[model samples]
Target: MTDSFLTISGFRKTFGSIVAVEDVSLNIPKGEFLTFLGPSGSGKSTTLYAVAGFDDPSAGDISIDGRSILATPPHKRNIGMVFQRYTLFPHLPVGENIAFPLRVRGHSAADIAKTVKAMLSLVRLEGFEDRLPAQLSGGQQQRVALARALAYDPPVLLMDEPLSALDKKLREEIQVEIRRIHQETGVTILYVTHDQEEALRLSDRIAVFNHGRIEQVGSGEDLYARPATRFVAGFIGDSNFLKVREVERRGSAASAILPDGTRIENIPAHAGNGHAATPELMVRPQSLKFVQGSGAGLAVKVKDVTFLGDTSSVLLETGWGQEIWLRGAGSAVKTNALSGPLHVEWNPADSHLFC
Candidate 1:
């Protein structure tokens, strides 16, 4: 933790009887892009605001460069921020807005001008320096706001759903820009967003928040492949949950009987409280494969199939009425024309078990 550039220890925020953030802790390495990702009111934003010094934690501390900054005010923390809305100054032209931060820090006018130009170039908005914010598109204004935040070269930049106001195409465009900017400057970034795609696109690691706590912190692949809890399994991707009866445990793996009475062995087991409660299976759509006979795996009746360009989604139902979805490449699935019961199979390692 001492090697981490930014450390948040036991951060908690309470509003009288309500707790917004509860015992959140994180360590962000220098130059690493870390994202706080979750749904609204899941404590992701509250934790970000605490780091930005907009709100104080009821208990705990935030530190930068191995030193505590809990006593520091927002302006003195030397952290830059972009919010859900563009906070650019409407009265100032783009050039002046980018120069404001440097000017406030008492940089010489010449240095401010130089920094502003470099920032504009970094964000690829060179010719629009003199244009008013109103004259620019939503994406353009956000780029200017980002330029202003980066003008002084803050050690950490915090972004909170900065592209939520833009259209889908524009949002994706700005996401690429943000990634490029991060790579260019190597500024340690603590980005906050509710979009999983955005987090997976930009973050070196993602901290998944839920119910005022971080359930897991890992790379996108880690969370999607091996989730720590039921909430995470459901949140990260398209997962089918099947209620299974726990048969036995062998070391870290467990044997469970599926709803269709097929026994699956060697599935990873993680019963959080050191005991299995009720066994459940979590499998991604793409993990299941179609097979020729019922002896290979569980049997399900094909209900529907939907084509989605590269992949097709196959909906299946167990005799007990449990629904399962599988994804196969378009060429692999000719089942849209073939009708009957089909067997679905998956490697035991491809599925996760939780209690």
Candidate 2:
């Protein structure tokens, strides 16, 4: 943490009566790809804007390499930004657009041209330098925007949904380019997006935001496999929450009875302070499996089955009329199997208890 390149400490932002962000702090090491991921109005952008010197925080400090930049102007902060829109100048050709930043910084013409060429090659737009922004496709324009942002050799790059405007296939393709650019330049990146899959694909670590605060921060695998809160568990992946009543508690291990009176033991318990919140068992769809007969499993009736390419989705209704989904191998469930009573079971270790 002492070597952290970007540090956000006790960050808080407010808009008169509305609090946009609340006491969020993070330490980002140099050259790491960190993402702010969450739904709309979650304060991820607010934090990023503060770092970019676009908005002054009501409280807290943001520092780069241990030096505070809060007193600096937006352009004087020496940071790069790529927004959702490809903000390339329409009249400028790709080469000139890329040279804009370096030109403004008073770099010599020779150095600007050399840097533009290298940047074009970095984004894989080697021969398109002569074309104007209006003549390029959406993906190509965005690539040019990226090249322009990196032209000045900024220490940090802030991307706010840079790929959100493209189609799915194009977005994925550009994601690969973005990753390569990050590696080639070694510039610290702080990306923002609501798409969880994109965050998982691009980030070294992700910060999940909700209601003006960070819910959790971890690797994609960590967030998916071992979520700290019910919000995080539900946000990062597909989950099924089943209502339950806690019957026993010993430290972090506890036992709970399902709605159908099936007692499950040794599950990880959280926030069990006997609050008004009801206890629920959180299980991933992939963790639930069909156990042969009615042998020590929850009784359910199959309602529907959907066959995806690599996996099949099976929907089942519990005896108490709660519906849940299970994902299995493509051939795991069949249409003919829907006629009889089905029982599903999961290991207690694979579940989390939340109240």
Candidate 3:
């Protein structure tokens, strides 16, 4: 939330007749961990490439510390980048790999040696200095890549799915290291990933991209709890959207009736430009609760239930044949008792009416 340290203004990129990225603009503060999150071909990588000088923008400007970097070449930009694959020099040892950037910048041998030692220690690879890229594990190789990228003490670091090559456990382990390095080094990081959980765990703020445009930007909680668009609602977390009818809107508060004549009132609603699409009630799986009687809530027949460690996932079918999921404490409902008819209800305040 500080003054803008890295700015992208009206950035646009196109490939022949197709548009890769629209006019995307964002202001990033110094030392902020911002993530560009979206599915593949959603313009996240295109924006990151523009920042790293890998691709030229058809329009708009990219500035760092109040100076435009559009005219600067990639090497002169002094920016660091790590890609999906580990781009380590196979013939060189870890120490030399970490020292490559420092050498390129014309640092003294003594300075390079000192920085290499510190960088190795920062990545928790203290004694692996003499090991080659082939000798180290995938995660360790990435740590070395990270060390190499930071060797020149760049002002900003750009990561493009750097952990996608690692296994789940290794990926999670390296995520912790990345966070620690970010805190210790205080470098502004622009990370790109399609994994929502990764973005939620790592970013100080997330920019959700969709179809060559940025749909929303906010903290994980903000996007999950109050999404500005239906796409964001469906992307940020697990959501169950039930079709609703007879929507009456007055300001931000609205009421609607379900297909089974269950009335919900005084809920937050978004009537998008007075469109005629059927409004949907967006609710999280955890927000629903099972009641005993049919008169209390929407009547449903339990289709299936799966016990998942600390939680239970229940799949239910409504009278109109719409399937929805409900997740709750594993011990809340017995497996044997869930087969019959049940009623599911949630607080009206917990749902959003999205048109």
What are the per-residue Cα lDDT tens digits for candidate 2 across 52-164?
A: 99999999999999999999999898899998987999989999999998888899999998999999999999999999999999999989999999999899999999899
> Which scores higher on lDDT, 2 or 3?
3
Candidate 1 wrong stretches, greater than 4 Å: 272-277
Badly placed stretches (over 4 Å) of model 3 are 271-276
- State the weakest 10-residue window (summed lDDT) of model 3: 270-279
lDDT of each: 0.89, 0.90, 0.91
What's the distance in Å from true for residue 19, model 2?
1.1
Q: How many clashes does the backbone of model 3 have?
A: 0
Question: Could you give me the TM-score of model 1 versus the true structure?
Answer: 0.96
* lDDT measured at residue 13 in model 3 versus the true structure, 0 to 100: 97
- Angstrom error at residue 336, model 2: 2.3
* Clash tally, candidates in order: 0, 0, 0
Q: Number of the top candidate by lDDT?
A: 3
Could you tell me every candidate's TM-score relative to the true structure?
A: 0.96, 0.96, 0.96
